[model samples]
Target chain A: MIRALISRIKQGYRTYPFPKKEPVLPERFNGRPVLNHDKCDNCRACEKACPTGAITSQDNKVCIDMGKCLFCGDCTSACPKGVIEFSKDYRLAANIRKDLLVSDKEIKLAQAIDKQSRRIFGRSLKLRQVSAGGCNACEADTNVLTTLTFDLGRFGIQFVASPRHADGILVTGPVTENMRLALKKTYDAIPSPKFVIAVGACAISGGPYIGHTETSNGANGIVPVDLYIPGCPPHPYTILDGLVTFLGRR
Target chain B: MSRQLISIYNNKSTDIGAVPNLPIDDFRETVINSVNTGRRIAAFFGLPHDNDSLKLIIVLADDHQSILHLASTCVKEKYPSLTPDCPQAHWFEREIAEQFGIRPEGHPWLKPIRFHHSYTNNDVWNRSANETILPCVTDFFRVEGSEIHEVAVGPVHAGIIEPGHFRFQCNGENVLHLEISLGYQHRGIERQMTTAPQNRLIHYMETAAGDTTIGHTMAHCYIFEGLASCSAAARAQVLRGIALELERLANHTGDLGALAGDVGYLPTSSFCGRIRGDFLNMTAILCGNRFGRNFMRPGGTAYDIEKSHIDDLRKRLNAALKDVTNAANCLWSTPSVLGRFEDTGILNKQICSQLGIVGPPARACGFDRDCRYNFPSGIFQFKQMPVATWDSGDVFARAYVRWLEIQHSVAFILDLLDSIPAGNIQNKISAMSPCKIAVSLVEGWRGEICHVAVTDNSGKLARYKIVDPSFHNWMGLAVALRNQQISDFPLCNKSFNLSYCGHDL
Candidate 1:
């Protein structure tokens, strides 16, 4: 015990200095969805692949409701150009609904082309995750995001335990029937002006498990979603990007 | 104890004097005959088939095993009660009653186990014959004592943990009986999986028991592979084995820490917890998501281990081992911690074997059963890993066994990394004809995780039943809690750390 205390003392202030300096994330960390319009081919694979309908395409233009996207990375894998790749940027904090949505017109096509070579990076944003009938995979990933190496806090992203203090809700799973009440209660508990980011295939169009008469389609079934991150289980980097996009720090 | 044994084989047997045969209609008579012969009832597994019928298979194990199958038609009729003869089938009977709307004719307590009342109709059996929704209800047990004040704790705990309720019948601190009520976290994973298409079933399988993701998914995939006559690639199998072992290591470490924390050993608790965190970080590094999400796909792993990643993992693992070993050594050095845990919450070998407990808890009580070694699958068949066990059957014995297992896990991981062959991480699985039923049994961190899958003619899931280790071990908790002081409850409960969500589903 004495040795442990001594070691802890020596380590000195290991807590991430968030909101000041950008936190360092691991290599494979999945944060948020980044749309590569050049290679997108305007094919709504990502829009169709999304389980929560977080991505909607109209007239060859795609728009991501950042409030609903889960950052599961399904779109990235399904996309032919690797265009919709996961960006390390996780600063997804927003003051209002309009800020979270990313439209095709919002993309600076020329800027996106040049930025492709500049290794994707961003400051960490505080994440508040809700288990809206999730099987707990998304929760597990969100929990791991704060570990030593990933040190999401280092990126200024902190996972506040309470919804009142949260900037966004990182939702996972295909909102199960029993969890519907709990989800509503949690969303209501969180003070408004709070963004909602759906994080897994379950949260996106219910992934492959949609159409279950027993479970909800996704978080949007109960609350308005801002971003859709897609994957059977979204990669950590993708989750980081979604958070950053919400923060407007990307 | 033998009274009468009769075996009659005929094409049609329904009347009282008729022989037991294929077309037997009366299930009550068969059950009565079995009970009259002094045969002890074992277990009953409800197998739901694609034809909308139910296959209730009961086992009577005495000196020999007599398996009885009662195939009920799709007429939605209530079956005769077996609990009157076999008191142990109380939970199973209640579950089957709630799920399939097949009432155990005379079950004294026929409460719903998983589903809520709002979900299913009061006359569920008489309702639409093919209805899938079931009900959920809480049934409290009667407690007897002087001024027996029943205090209910949780559905929401003080700490960050899963939800479960405990009804403690106590006179101040002196406890009379403890009744555990779970299912608060039930998300109806089984019902959701049944509705999912075959190709997408893996998503549901991974979520069935989140912590036991790889274990459950492997079992689910194995069942599908077995039914489809397909095999995962050797590389995929080895990768899965590695992931499973890592899961076991992380959980055991976290549990050990929690156990120590329950005993008020903060130093040991923090140290072990930090080690667990490190392990979780390692998992994140390899799979991109910690707690092992998306690691195991149907035919193989979703992600492959890069050479550099393996090297990084080896480094982290070595450091973690050193730290964890040091922490455990410190814990052993503290005499108070050892004294508090040594003989607390003892479950004797006899009770353990009778209850058919599995995994570390059962191993601690001297029952030598480990699916990894006994029922070898994948690379486990080729590797040499020690199965840790102890006969003490106490809290300390369980902790010691876990400590030993963690060491074994480290060794196994190193071995796997050293011998990992270069190959494709995944393989393509072809479609197969429906009406195929396959069962998969895997040794999870807790115990055996069994998944039974049946596919329809269109290659979609007709029914999927997942039996987590926690379901079988819930009884172990009741037995362990008996006669123990209320103060020792946390220590006993943490020693098991059974997943309420896993069990409820």
Candidate 2:
């Protein structure tokens, strides 16, 4: 017991003061990607190098779909004129799917739910996390929020085990066909006035597994997603930001 | 009289014709004989040979000699089952029967592994092509007694975990049998690897087992390099090694915390949880992604550590290790935590060997079966880290072995970071040689991660097989549950902490 106490003291208070103070992200962390269309020569090198077809030249404009991007920075390397580079802006979440298409303009970030829904769930939001076919990276990062460093409970947000007790569902995966029925069943089990948040590139736009017969693209057609958080697997801060912002607490 | 198998080293490519081609009967006999002589079955899978035949390939590892043996046979429909004679071939045979439309006749248990349609038009179970297949909806092993009750858990579990179904037959509190039925997380990764766009191949490999991103991607990179008949430079190899060990350190630390959490020990659980993130953050310092995505390429690592970053990594690692030490020591020093861990879910060494388990669970059973030690590749070929083992084969042993590995991995990373050689971080990989087969093994935190690649006549990837450690270790968890208390399921499950999608894929 003494050792535990001593160790607890040595560990100290390690939680980040996000929103109040900017968190320390790594120097190399690539959160949101920016495409410089002025420098692009329509070489199509980025389109070819993209593993998920996230980069494209549409209407004579180069656009990167953050929902489909793995945040791999391959497009940046393929671009000869420095047309593409990922910025350290971690705020990559949206209420609508089309907003995730970053084409030089800033992304209209996620907004809080409607007045009535916010009034009901703004405080003490209980979520049921469903991983349809996630690679566990999304699941792990989302799960990290409950740790001391993130302490999600302080914001009255808790991940409940049963959907019956949840105000919403936060899903991660490409939504494989095998899990389609199960995911639907889970979403249905939650009470009415419930919302769904799709986390990760897989859940938002199927990530790299898009257009596969085995997967249903993502949570789009399976369930109506209230928020979209994009990354190969979004970082913990991104997830927390999405959650609190959707709840009107951020 | 002919050679039964061709010998090859890890991460080495060989001519397809050099592998011995035997008849199905000889192939079965040779595989059984090799297992009897204490060889391990590394990978066994079937690929389409022609419209009518399926070619089965087996890669056996002679760990004592650090050699890999390969052989193949073409079977039109059926092959004699190797599971009856060699228990290690059980899962592989079941997987082959599922993937290809071949029947492994006389097998004790023949059931669908991933609940997906067979690769060929021929259906082994004679299920119609149009009918949609559902997972874990089949008949399971039954124990008939009025007192024996069955408990069914889900594809959607209570926790934030991957999907899988678990059915337990219990006589009151004691479990008689625990059958695990998975495939809910199947995204057809293996199928995609064969047909996906070239650029997407590495992305699929990165998520093959997402938590082991570095490990699985390292295996794919080695396979690609082998097919190209090139190797990563010494500096790149060392960087890859550092990333792999960091992955190991992060996972082991997390597992230890999870094991403690399962036992309701909060102090260590809480501390280790945050520490796990710290280790992951350190990984982000090297690569942009915490899971090390986009850090590995075909020839070498995509990113190289700067000198200042190396010092930063060393300092952070030391700091995290110190905290983890205190957190882990709480597990050992606490009698109540040890009580729940020791003598719980005991899987003896014989069952572990028979089941062909790998990783910490196998090491916990006193088998020094680490791929890094037995099948050296990359930086492992230059430097050595002793295999950590524990003999109890219980949950305590599993947790203890992870702790030992954590210490060793930290030391390895620190030592390597201090002396990272100066060289190029990547090599330009040229066109791969046609009609060649290559095998790459990486000791992922869970266990041995095996990737076998076969290039066709046009230098396209003909077949790619990934054998995640969870594939071999899941059965061990089921067997461990036998005669154990039903309430201890979470504790035992956390100790093994096998991957659902890795197995399903």
Question: CA shift at A200, candidate 1, in angstroms?
Answer: 7.7
Identify the runs in model 2 with alpha carbons over 4 angstroms from their true place: none
lDDT of 2 by residue, B1-505 (tens): 2399999999999998898889988988898888778788999998788889988999998888899999999988888888998898888888888888899999899988888898888777888888899888788999999999999998888878998999999999999999999888888888888799988999998887799999999999999999999988788999999999999999999999999899998988899999999999988998978999989998888898898899899899999999999999999999999999999999989888878889999999999899999999999988898999999999999999999999999999888987889989999898999999999988999999999999999999999999999999999999999999999999999999999878876
- Candidate 2 chain A weakest lDDT stretch, 10 residues: A17-26
| Prediction RMSDs, each to the true structure | 7.7, 1.0
- CAPRI-wise, candidate 1 is incorrect
TM-score of model 2 vs. true structure? 0.99
lDDT of 1 at B175: 61
Return the top candidate by DockQ.
2
The number of the candidate with the highest TM-score is: 2
